[model samples]
Every structure is written in structure tokens, then in C-alpha cells.
Target: GSASGGPDEAVRQADRLAKDAGAPASGTAAAFVNAARELGMTRVSLATPYDEAQTETLAGYLRAAGFDVVRAVAGGPASPAEAAGWNAEAQAKLVREAAEPGPDGVLLACTALRTAAHIPQLEVAAGRPVLTANQVSVWEALRLAERRVREPALGTLFTVLPPVRG
Candidate 1:
């Protein structure tokens, strides 16, 4: 069953489970926010493959995490399979289209969408950092494990060290 109170409840449940298992708790939502903060991104544009409602929820989550979502565009894909089928060029176009003049970064917000292959191109086009869900997840996992690895082809998120969190 879905969490009764949306993302907040989902996070709480994840924390509970992690504690029960004697492990650190981490969620993709928190990872995304932390990644953005690490990059010093205060404002961002969002590109998602979800419908209007899901997109709005995602934007709200980002907002609650302290990001200013200056622009948001949804591709309205009917299913995850459709989202995954989106090619690099199409995804780059969506990122470019959704990007505004002053956002600190552009976020491609779905793990289902094929985004990693095009992150470099998207970052160049957007003229800022471009973070995809899968990329951030990997980064966060490494961070939680106290491991640091740098691979430039994966984009700045990997190439640069994450900021220290108190």
C-alpha cells in the first residue's frame, strides 16, 4: 500500500525499516535535495515523465526540501515503459525547453527515463548542472558508504566532491 500521508509518511516508514535493519536510512527524494544543495543550486527547472498531478507532487517535494522550482514540465508519458523509451535527444530537448534563464540547475526527475546517457549534453545545453534520479541515487549511496569516486563522463555531480554536511 502507498504511504498514507504521501512522501513524509513514506520517508518515516523508510527510516523505521532502516533502523529495524540497523542501517542508515536514505531516500531518493532526500538524495536529490542533498545533491542539489551540494552543487549549490538554489533554483532549478524540472523535467519529468509523469502526468500533471505527479509532477506537481514532485515539485512540491523539491520546494519543501528548500529548492525554488522555477520551471516544471511534464512529458505526460502514460507508463514507465514509455518513459524509458524516450531517447537521449528527446530528453535533452525537454531539459532545454523546461530550463529558464536563471535556474541554478535542471533536474530530470525519473529513474524510469533514460537520462544518464545524455546528462553531459543536457548540462551543456542547460548551461548548468543536470541531475538525473539514478545518478543522484548512486552518488548518495556512495556518500552514505563514505566512499568518493569521480567519473567525469557522469557529469559534475560525480566529478566534484559533495559539500560537507554538519
Candidate 2:
């Protein structure tokens, strides 16, 4: 679910809803931040399938979580249908271009874009982590479930995630 007010409020609201439902919830922005933190990334570049306004909103959320937004580029298909049509090469190009000039990592912030297969390649080119929403979401879910997995193909995150909290 998208944030209604702001990033902090969205996190609080998600916490309340999760408490009410008696289940753990993983908000995408929160999960992204946590994964970045776990990887010790301070400076980040953002590449999104959103338009400028939406992309800035996502950057705002990341900034609120204390990441340094060193660069942000918005391109690619903003809609789900268009994003679904985007291929691995296209996603790689976007992430690689966004990571220029050296940030600690790049964040691909759209769940609609297929990114898992390209993460390893992108990280190699960027010489830093390339985190996708779907990737971090799954990592956070597994962490919340107390399941430990180390899938190197996913990117550095999979190989270096902090130990599960139990």
C-alpha cells in the first residue's frame, strides 16, 4: 500500500494495521530502507519507473529514512502494463545509468519491473549494490518469518543480510 500522508505516517499506520491483524507487515519503503541499512549503504541513487512527481515522493521516503539521496532519475514505464513489457536489458540500462559518479548503491523502486535476474549484472557494473523493491520485499518477508536464505544470484544483499531476528 502507498503512503497516505508521508513516509513516517505510513510506517506507523502499517504498524497499527499489522498489530490489529496479528501478523507482521512489510511496507515496501520500510523494507527498502532496512535492507539498505543492513548493507551499510549511506549514499544512494534512485531509479524508478515512476514519473517525476512519484519518483520524488519515493526519494522523500528514502531521505526520511536517513539515506543520502545522491542522485535520482525517473524513466521507464510508469504504468503496470508498460512496466511489464520492460525487459532485463532495459532495467539494467536504467540502473547502470543511475549509478554513475559513485553512490554507495542504486535503488530500483518499482515492484512492477522484473529485476531479479538483472540484479547480479547491474551490481557488477555499478560496483555497488542494486536493490529492487521485489528483492528487498522478499528479503524482509523472509526475515520477518525467521527464515534464513542466501541466494547469491539475487545480489550482494542475499549474501550479506544480517542474521534473522528469530
Candidate 3:
């Protein structure tokens, strides 16, 4: 037999079970600002572990939020079971190729997708500021701190934006 419950109960159960889904809360934008400024990028590419349709929806959402997603990559894994299956080599290659040259930032979607593990490497390879779902919220938050932050370990987070004095 399978689990049975009301809609609300199901939702509650889902929320509980999904607590470990790896999706960070909404607070990365501040961190992202710092990342962007440090990285010296104003535009960015879009990478995702969701399907094409969902990716489109995400792109629209980001656009609505005022982020420019120049390059687009979708579907890191086929299903929830495969979420972490975002083949690092393939994914990195895809993202590298998809990224548009000369941008302010880069975002890899789906926090549950395990791309954060590759953030540093990806940034080095892409040679740009790369922020995943969770990282962006943090980035935005950090920018709000009113401090000059340089997160070298995170690579992209430490990247500075274009020179203002220039």
C-alpha cells in the first residue's frame, strides 16, 4: 500500500520530507550583489536542473526579478532521483559553452541539484561569477551588509564587478 493523506497533510508531509531537499531559503540575493560587484559582471547566463518547460518558467521569473539570463542550459537530471546526477563534466561543459561572453553574472538553478559542489570549479572554468540558487540569495544578502567582501573560496562570490573609476 501507499501513503494516504489529505491535501494539507500531504503538503505538511512534503514540507517535512523536503526539508532536506537542499533548497535554500530566500536570502541569497544580498550575497549575490557582493558577488556581482566583486566579479565585475552585470549580465549572466542561466543553468538549470529542471526540464525545458520549467527552465522557461524560471527564466521568466528571473527576468521578472530583473536578472539578465543570457545563456540557457536546462535539465541537469531527469527526475528527482536523478537530481544529483547533473554530470559534473557534462554539466560543466554545457554551462561553459552556454555562457555568453562578457556578462555580469551566471546562475545555476535548482538548489536541490548539487551544483554548489562544483561552483568554484565552474567559476574558474567559465571565468565569471557563477551563483547557484542558494548562492544568489546569499550574494544579495552579503551586498546588503555594506562591506567589501571577497569570498575567494567561492570564486564567483569573490569576483568583482566592472571598475567604477574607469
Candidate 4:
């Protein structure tokens, strides 16, 4: 879910709220960017279940975080329930389609889309890292806790330890 204001401000507000609450938080977009950075990705392509404008907002967020948004595409179920209905094959196809040659990695955005089961296959097809919302959330949570465990089935993010943040 997106906040009311622009992407950058939304992120800042979220962080501030989390800090005020004395809790750690990693927004999905931030987690996606972190996952991309950990995988050594500078250029990224995004695929989402939102319309073009929403997709561009996410791309803007990534750009604000210092990534080059090489490409962004959106075309999936219109609602969360519809996205949740997508199967692994459909999700894989969406990622693959967004895996245009320019990006070092692809970001499958949308927490509603189930992608934990197909990331490996999607990465192979894209020949690069594939970061998804849910996957990166898990990754950032583990990194916040300062724990790293290898779970190869979840794809490369799980295999590499997150970089230490200063």
C-alpha cells in the first residue's frame, strides 16, 4: 500500500513513524532497493500489478534511492484479491516479460502476488536477480535482526547476506 504523499516523503514519514514507535520497519520499496543493492544491481526493471502512474511512482522511489530505473511495466489484476489469485506460472511470465535486457535485475512489486515459489526460475530466465515485495520484506526483516541464513529455494537474496548499514 502507498502513502498519501509522494514516494520520497512517504518513505521518510514511514521511517519517522517507525522510529518514534521504537520499532524497526522496512517498507517494501526500500526492501526491494536494498535487495537490489545487495545483489550488485545498479539498473533495474519493475513489474507491478498497478497502472502506469503507480508503477512510475515506484520507479521514482527507486530513482530517489539512487537506482537507474531502466524500464517499468504494469499489467496485472486490478485489485489485491485478483493479484493474490495469480499462480506461479503467471507470476513468472510477468517477471520474464519485464526482464528486458537493460536492467541488471528485475523487481516484481506487489505484496499480493505470490512469487516465493518461482523466483529461481524467473532469475534463470532473466539471467539476473529477481526481487519481489514479499521476498525482500523477509530479507530486510532478517537483516534488521542481524541474522543470515541460506535458503536457496527462495533465490539469490536468501543466499547472500545483507550489507551492514552505517
Candidate 4 deviant stretches above 4 angstroms: 1-7, 162-166
In the order shown, the candidates' Cα RMSDs to the true structure are: 2.7, 2.0, 9.1, 2.5
Best by TM-score: 2
Whole-model Cα lDDT of every candidate shown, in order: 0.80, 0.84, 0.57, 0.81
Off by over 4 Å in 3: 1-40, 138-150, 158-166
Give TM per candidate: 0.89, 0.91, 0.61, 0.88
Residue pair clashes in candidate 1: none
As a TM-score, model 2 comes out at 0.91
Model 2, 1-166: lDDT tens digits are 5733567787887789889989888678888888899899999999988788888888888888788999889995379888867898888888888898799999988888888887898787677899999999999889788776889999998998565466
Residue 109 displacement (Å), model 2? 0.8
Candidate 1 segments whose C-alpha is farther than 4 A from its true place: 1-10, 162-166
Question: TM-score of the candidate numbered 4?
Answer: 0.88
Candidate 1 vs 2: which has more TM-score: 2
Which residue pairs collide in model 4, if any? Answer: none
* lDDT assessment of candidate 4: 0.81
What root-mean-square deviation over C-alphas does model 3 reach? 9.1
Report how far residue 34 has shifted in candidate 1, in Å.
0.8
